[model samples]
Target chain A: MDQAELAAKFRNKDIKAFERIYSDYSDSLFGVIFGIVRDREIAEEVLQDVFFKAWDKAETYSAEKGRLFTWLLNISRNSAIDKTRSKGFKNKNKNSDSSFYVDILETRDKTEIDIDVNYIRSMLGRLKERCVKLIELLYFKGFTQKEVSEELDIPLGTVKTNNRNCISELRKLIQT
Target chain B: MNVEEYIASGILELYVAGVLSEEENRDVHAMILKHPEVREEIEQIEKAIVRHTAALAPGTVPSFEFIKTHTAGKQVPVRSLQSKKTYSWITYTGWAATIVLASGMFFMYYRINNLQQDIKRAGDQNIQLEQQISDVRKDAEATEELIEILRQKDIVTITLGGQAIAPESFARVFWNKKDEIAYVDVSGLPEPPEGKVYQVWSLKLDPLTPTSMGILDQYDSDNNKIFALANPNQSQAFGITLEPEGGSATPTMDQLYALGVVSAS
Candidate 1:
């Protein structure tokens, strides 16, 4: 089935749809969660919690609010961030790395990443450092448009447009 | 309205990030429905972000089975107490200590009754909720089993289309030749007339012979509507027909509701 049909089944609490959705989007969501948590086991725990909550709350999902990937991304970020703030996670990962996720392309080895690692690295290579940071903050960090503008020291008007331009650049790079 | 300008405004990017306000999100969704191009633009942007982020995914994450086994029937809904208690104490005392003592005892008796009633209601509700949970669990378990059975590579799936007697009625047979079993799914069939039941049959196309597999006795109660019938015949086709309550001695060609020949796999 197409994504729309799959999402309809998912909204109906179909377990098969959930399985297919897990296969389709779990990787990207895990990456977003992994970027925030920094610890593998905790990220895994948070990932599991995220899926559990997603399945439980699937009935409440409305297509008008957002696409499924964005919804899953939002849930992953919120869950991972919540995990990081929890006392258990803090005690477990006291010395965990706190580097920005924008540097993942340059820092993480290829073997540890996905098959499209080189493609993403090249895409990030082409993007300006600020562009990469903006995507990371806005997409992975769950930063609001206002928060993004504040963090980047740009006017509120520019963040949306600037992030737009950055994603457009990425889309172009992907096609070629 | 300029579609390209709306696409260029970058709100779609914010939309994908979920950073847009509720009203803004609604507007974006409306535009997406009104203009396919807007939807395409949003999809392209989402693809870029999904791919970019996915590239950083770990080489291995837990499998879907991890989710299945972990989350199965773990949700026990929190019950609402739904209690309404109103207190009323207007005492006219001839002697303060005696009045207070008497009122205190009266209040305790009344409070105990109210508490007992609440406890009883809560207990009944808990039983009902547990029954519902178990019923749902049974349905889910049965469905999971059927899905596993259907996923087997050796199962031959034959779609029995509606016949002239009931053009709208249909069924499916999952024939496992090695196991000598055929699962008949009769979800699409209409309710049979009173005193008549739908009987499954294994057919031999060359000789035009029919053998009664079994009647769907629990058709009304079966939520899954899948009946596993023991079929040890070297059958070439499968059919379902409305027959007498106990079934017929021979083929009921006139009553054939659905029929399909097993294709060469």
Candidate 2:
């Protein structure tokens, strides 16, 4: 079975299941939260809180509802947004700028990660500006199709097909 | 459903993002399960998003031990102080004249409370026994009334033979067409598997439509193993199938234990 399928069958109180899920999805989840919170320590704290919520509410998670990643993403986005609004996080970073995920990647120069920064940057350069904004708004910011349509001033119908094409391109890039 | 067209619609990406309405999400989820191509497409979209985000992860996660301890430790109940107290009242205390007097008074109070509780408990038990006797008598009267109803001249007896799945198990159905009631006897059938009960179906075999005629509950406790059910349909056949607890919407053909057809009356 795939990692998504395995992560859905968590034993609520089992530390082994919690450990396995943490190891599997924590990096992606941390990245998503970190993308929003933009602070390592605050993002990490939010990430921990997200998993604790997941562990406590394991019975509510089911494969039939949505993918395990989707479930965790929802939790991470809500928690990080809530953190950003809090007094502590507001004091640290007040400016919520217009930089998308692509901007975030361009600034980070970590070699230890499997991501070949220059190669991905060159490939992502081909992905349109609108595609990055759509992903950032939809995935990172948790905007609905209606909200995205209003934000981008594009027809709602185009938002869907454009995302499909952009993700397909990203899939090919990542697979290679 | 056109798999290619559906996959190209791009709702699966939104689905992976978890932004769709619950109803919309369920529709996409059902599509993923129904079509292998849809599931593959959804997995690919999710992988792309996960990988893209994971590439930008800030730093290494702390050791799993921190999370493990936090999650595991929080559920543990605090050891209440009451749990630690030793109730060994027989232990010796300081031997003083005042201590002896105090002990005598404490013993007298304990004995009075204990005797009073014992008397009250005995009275409660006697009342419970009397109530049980009355309940049994009521049950006997109900059974006698049922027997009388079954013995009426209008009652039509139908013997249901065991199906291939359970050849040893069979049941009898007594129907009163005028009253629109069917009395089912399941004494011959063995106990149903755990979490399963025998559901009776009133069927019309021309187009093969089945209507539920209630379930045969209390299979173990009934002395005669007979249950009365409402059968408002002009049933051509009677069937019993083992179903999950609370019964199923339709009869499970493989688990059909007994089936019998009504006479052409």
Off by over 4 Å in 2: A1-8, A91-95, A101-120, B76-265
- What lDDT score belongs to each candidate, Candidate 1 first? 0.81, 0.80
Give per-residue CA lDDT, model 1, range B1-265, as digits (tens). 3787688778899889887655667889899889999988888888888878776666667888889876587767999998886544533343666878999999999999999988866754554465456558768989999999989988999999999988988999999888988999998889888899999999898878889899997776678899999999998899998888888777588998999999876
TM-score of chain B of 1: 0.62
Report how far off residue B118 is in candidate 2 (Å): 58
| TM-score attained by model 1 | 0.54
Q: Per-prediction DockQ, in order?
A: 0.25, 0.25
True contacts kept of each: 0.64, 0.66
Q: What would the per-residue lDDT of candidate 2 be over residues B100-214, giving only the tens digit for each residue?
A: 9999999999999999988866754554465456558768988889889999999999989999988988899999888998999998788898789999999999999999998
Those runs of model 1 whose alpha carbons end farther than 4 Å from true positions after fitting are A91-117, B74-265
> Model 2 Cα displacement at A8 (Å)?
5.5
